[model samples]
Target: MEVGVWWTRFRAVLAFSDAVVVLGAAACVPLLGGARDPWPVLLAAAAAWWVALGVGGSRDQRYLGVGQEEYKRLVSVTVHLIGVVALVALLLRTDAPRPYLTTAAPVGAAALLLTRWGWRQWLHARRRHDPTWSHRVLLVGNGATVDHLSRQLASRAHLGYHVVCTWEVTSAHEVDIAETARALVRLARRNEADVIAVTTSDALSSELLRRLGWLLEGTGLQLVVVPGLLAVAGPRVHTRPIAGLHLLCIEEPTFTGATRVAKRVFDVAAAGAALVALSPALLAIALAVRTTSPGPVFYSQTRIGKHGRPFRMVKFRTMSTDADHRRAELLTANELDGPMFKMRDDPRVTPVGRWLRRYSLDELPQLFNVLLGRMSLVGPRPPLPDEVRRYAKDTRRRLLVTPGLTGLWQISGRSNLSWSDGVALDLQYVENWSFTTDLVILWKTARVVVAGTGAY
Candidate 1:
């Protein structure tokens, strides 16, 4: 089947699921002591919520199978649904029960998000086995950009982009604008591609891009221009049309103001709560580390935090007391590249330490670091002073925000991640930091910890 047909069917499934959830929530309102003859209020609320989800671009094809934008739209729509419900009640002079509105909003939103997540999993699973479910992408650009973009897309098959072919235009002088555009169209047709993704290239001028769009008119092929910038999130970018030219406006991420305050507050509150909740486990781990190894239960190491500030980062001792003494001997056997030292089976690691590190239980003591304002619940990994010294200028951006106990680096393959890959993930997180993104990362961290595939 065509990718469009599959997407359309998936969207319909989402709409139907949403309708069922909304109606189901409305039906339960009367039981919750809602308006007596709640039929009118219930039906109106259900109809409005369902329609709002549809028209609000909650299920837009662009965000259907990838990224957090779809979930963001769902959240925005749900928030607006509340305002619309209240406004309607005021205008109609109906005594819409507060309980019903409150109940419906949260319940409906949760159910909708849950269903969407489940459906996304299903779509990803299907796409992995059968490429027909994904968008066949034709990449056009300079060789370097094409290579980078292709690798990224191919690595994440869940994103639903399958690269079919590439047209590498080395320079603007080598290719005529009209000829390039026509060649892209013919190439896309030959490959049966659904999308033409033109990566950043001087060979593709604005006029040529515009001409390509003109030529693609009524051709049912999607045109996407990939910017040169890397690791940028949708929230940080805005596009506007002025004087018939599209201008891309990129927003710089700010680490100050109310958002920073909110983040600090969240880190403190969450870290405190986590410590309280996991107190019993923490004690057990400390006891295990002390009894299993002839060393102190905790290890403290100087790590670079925000702005290159050094702090003693604490963790449950996951190595023998002589681990540091033996480090010089194993330095040559380091499994990971760059400044970080990681050995899958180092002789200095105690048996208990190995278990703790496997599931990252050793990092639990970092909750104290988070409380102490020396680290964050989520951000880039706290770098070693040696690692910081070796960092390139671009890599120093990790210090712009407080270091994290667990971050994209931790959740994304942890020790298994190549140093460059880990650095890229950290940079991406630094640029796209958000409360919602943090919540998502924390949730994923739980799953990753349990799997323990990437941990040493």
Candidate 2:
């Protein structure tokens, strides 16, 4: 039941799962009609991939159930393995069997990813039911920072950090570094905590942090120092060691150039393809909206986009024909805070509109907006002019990129998210934009839309 035991068992199961998947995929190459004498190349590639994953830090205890780093490393290892296989084939002048090189490798890689995801899901379930299965974390810092960090960790149980103890030292007076370090180690040992999460403060200076690390040198306890700067993504952060000092460097957020062009191209192509593929469903939704309500099939409202530009955002009409005119009467009944308006059971929403909104079928028309260069497949939610006007200076950063049909807001909680929380998620996405992030968001959007949580 201890955290270390659970982690060891989890990692062992994950390795076993990876090996089975790799061998299964390799075995299928021959069964699925591959080249003769394929066993040597196929088996070698499988063994290499399995070993790479085990040694590549993909299964590191720190990255098991949290963040995208594990998945990213998995992808990187797969790519490297494939490149090595191809180079070997070219140098030896022996054409690798197409099935072994292409089909088996890709299948094995996909299966490995799925296997890791499955193990994460299992680990999360176990942690949820038995918090002891999670990483026992001891929080160390000033009171305010510790409280803030504790609240964050408590809210995200799936991250597997369970706060077991807190050591709040006041910054008003200098503290004894050695004494504090010894006390921290004692507290961690007494509480059986696997991690010591420290928030930076004057009282817990760099010297104290260094001492704490030294005390925990061979204790097998992780020392996690949370920098004062919050909401910065990993991809935007880099570490530079200079003159015996480790410096944290934050890269400027990307907004234009090749990244923009790549994003734009992806948006247009995906939107165009989605429009064609879902034409029939779109027609059905359009017909339902038109027949069930006395309003037009599509509703276009002026929304604020990138750089504060106003554009007509279109969606399947999910309210009455006079929805805007009747909005004044329902202003006081709005369920959401801030400038946005939302109601769980608004009287103006038609029966069909309610259904459309639940599954987000109403937002399908925005694919056209995406194709028109006014919107993106993934970015901050497009705000209304009133909302934009109410935005504080920092909040205005959401306009740096084209608005999205679905973004962090859509997956996090949609209408269920508070105004401050919504702003924070948007800002995090804006500051940490990556193509991989977009893909992950898009993939999660499908599940959120199906579950219909946080939607009115």
Candidate 3:
């Protein structure tokens, strides 16, 4: 199962799914008592929608497996299709069925998106166990750049990239661009690679990159140029071609703005609603903890928040009353790397406490922290004061925003993550924070909690 062949099949499936959605929407129009000859109208609408999707690049392979670009293109195409329908009706001056058009557009778009999401889930699941679904990549660049890019890609296996081999250029000046391109082609062919990824290097000039692209032309292998910049989100990075050079302009991350305000508003509304809606469950958890453990129902610990401020983060007590006193005794048995302490089977944890921690029910009390503006619904995990004290200068940037009840680290692996990995994820979130990213994290958090992985 070569990646190229698999991708072609995947694309065909997507096309079929889109066609089915269009047909279903058309079928709905006749059922809704639209025009006498609904077939013509339905066909016209379907054709227009398909054309719109093509024009908007909704089916672009580059955006298929990763990022929100695919979703954005779908939304854009759907909107354009609706507008086209309205304009045509206005110009033709005919009795158009407004209800049918409105209903079909939304329904079709939703179905298409849902279908794509389902496929993505299936693909990701397959990738978890088998690398066959992933593109075999031939990496070429300077040593440092290649290693960095390889690690980044390897960490995100869900993106479907497997680095098969790497060619390290000690000095780009020593090799000619034409020769390098030939070498790359040979390596790709030898490794049966589906993609050739060249990381940005100081030695390689833009002209050389262009030459490589020209060499890869009509070769069936995709050539991807990885920019040197790290931790930059797509929205912040804009490509501008000026003077025959592709310049990537990166924007600084926003800390305060209308977007930030919207995030705050969402956090407040969601946290408040959850507190009210889950009050019964919260009460039950409190009672369970109180009856099962010889400790207070709630545990409040000093955690570092935004700008190094300290706040009392509350959680349902998940350990015995003497847990803190016994911390020194278990220090030698700490299972987690870095400053945080974790043990899969700690003697201090009561049976009920273990269950609460597993599903993150213990952290439900943090809705109060979010409501009080001491935390957010999505951000970096709140670090204990002792953990914060061990932070390096670069890690301190995570404090620029409020801590979160759930975040990249939480949804990623929770206690299973190494300290450095957790910090890397947190820093990535801090540097590329967006409302969309928050929504994705929150959605993933639900799944992670349900699975109860990496929870201690």
* lDDT tens per residue, model 2, 142-203: 99999998988887777799999999988636688888899889999999999999988887
Model 1's number of clashes is: 0
Where does the lowest 10-residue lDDT sum fall in candidate 2?
Answer: 33-42
By the lDDT metric, which is better: model 1 or model 3? 1
lDDT of 1 at 87: 86
Model 2 residue runs over 4 Å out of place are 35-48, 82-99, 172-174
lDDT of 1: 0.88
C-alpha lDDT of candidate 2 relative to the true structure: 0.88
Instruction: Estimate, for each residue in 150-223, the C-alpha lDDT of model 1 and write its tens digit.
Output: 99888778779999899999878887988889999999999889899988777778888889999999998999
Candidate ordering by TM-score (highest first) = 3, 2, 1
What are the TM-scores, per candidate, against the unseen true structure? 0.93, 0.93, 0.95
Strongest candidate by TM-score:
3
- For each candidate, the alpha-carbon lDDT, in order, equals 0.88, 0.88, 0.86
